[model samples]
Target: MPSSFSSQMLSSGGLGLAAGLSLIVAIGVQNAFVLRQGIRQEHVGAVVAVCAVSDAVLITAGIAGLGAVVEQADGVLRWLTWFGAAFLIGYGLLAVRRALRPSAGLEAERAATTTSVAAAVSTALALTWLNPHVYLDTVVLLGSIGNGEGPSGRWWFAGGAVLASLLWFTILGYGARLLAGFMSRPSSWRILDGLVALVMLTLGVLLLVRG
Candidate 1:
């Protein structure tokens, strides 16, 4: 009985971890922000914490029945979708401005650091909360899968999923620092910011269309 239960738990948790990673590994707006912060070594800890904690809350909320609520509350999501679309587009525009502006790599990063911690934190919060896609992914999809683990393994699955979020954000946020050396060039910043702008704009337009 013990061995069977252990196997079940491990299998369920492992699957959750894999699923969570798969969903998060993509280059999205949120990840782009985290990577930019990480590469700049500016407010990385705060950014990573915000992302991990937000994921945890969203994933847990989904498991706790918010997924069902979201499914029924179409109006709520619609508002969020519009709000998110606007925010993303605005952020993308800012990225475009940065990309077009010439910068000396480290000099630009230093300038960015002058942006108060409060500003960085605010940006992180907005990027995390304003995105409706996060809800559909974490709350609806991930939550549904975690709950599908059956009552016995559901919590275990959630644990794994939550762990995955922590691990992913931690790595992405911190791992970006590895590229700090390469990103020291002005051209690198322009290229990265350009890609970020493209991603944010595309996603924002898609959200508006979907809404």
Candidate 2:
């Protein structure tokens, strides 16, 4: 490819990366779940892979014009919003229970039987797919923006988005281990679970209210 074309692709990819991260690097259920798994160090790889791969697929689909199809499905998203909200609220309550119970803290988490890989993967998928914002942000917003970058630029932008997803999840899922030592205390885990509970419940209620 010509140097000019190469430069354009690079620019597009950088733009895509920034945009993708902007939408992703926020306090969300997906990030919270991934972080929790990372701290537990159970099936961390599977969770990260599911999240990254899911993002790539969604981003690609959005840019490929499936976003238009999604745009026409307002009713479906509303239903999903209800379901997602219910799930988040339920999960948040579980987190609340975990926080309230000292036995459920990270200090004793190691002795607890880890969840199956299939269960982890399933939860990851639900967290990714259930959120209506995922479709609107990853598909509709990113799709429109990436598609506007022209044909070649669109794919380059998509590559950047996929890269961002991989990079962020890898960092978040693994980097959280650095805190494993500090979080070894039961109180710390309690606090973490409490925060998770707050996030989940807040997001859940907001989803329902917005819907």
Tell me the whole-model lDDT of each prediction, alpha carbons only. Answer: 0.89, 0.92
Please give the range of 10 consecutive residues that has the lowest summed lDDT in model 2: 104-113
Candidate maximizing lDDT: 2
lDDT of 2 by residue, 1-211 (tens): 6997999789999989999999999989999999999998989999999999999999999999999999999899999999999999998998999888766456477566378999999989998898888889999999999999998999999999989999999999999999898888888888888999999999999999999
Name the runs in model 1 displaced over 4 angstroms. Answer: none
Task: Report the Cα lDDT for residue 143, model 1.
Answer: 85
Q: Candidate 2, 157: how far from true, in Å? A: 0.4
lDDT, candidate 2, equals 0.92
User: Could you tell me how far off, in angstroms, the CA of residue 112 lies in candidate 2 after the best superposition?
Assistant: 2.4
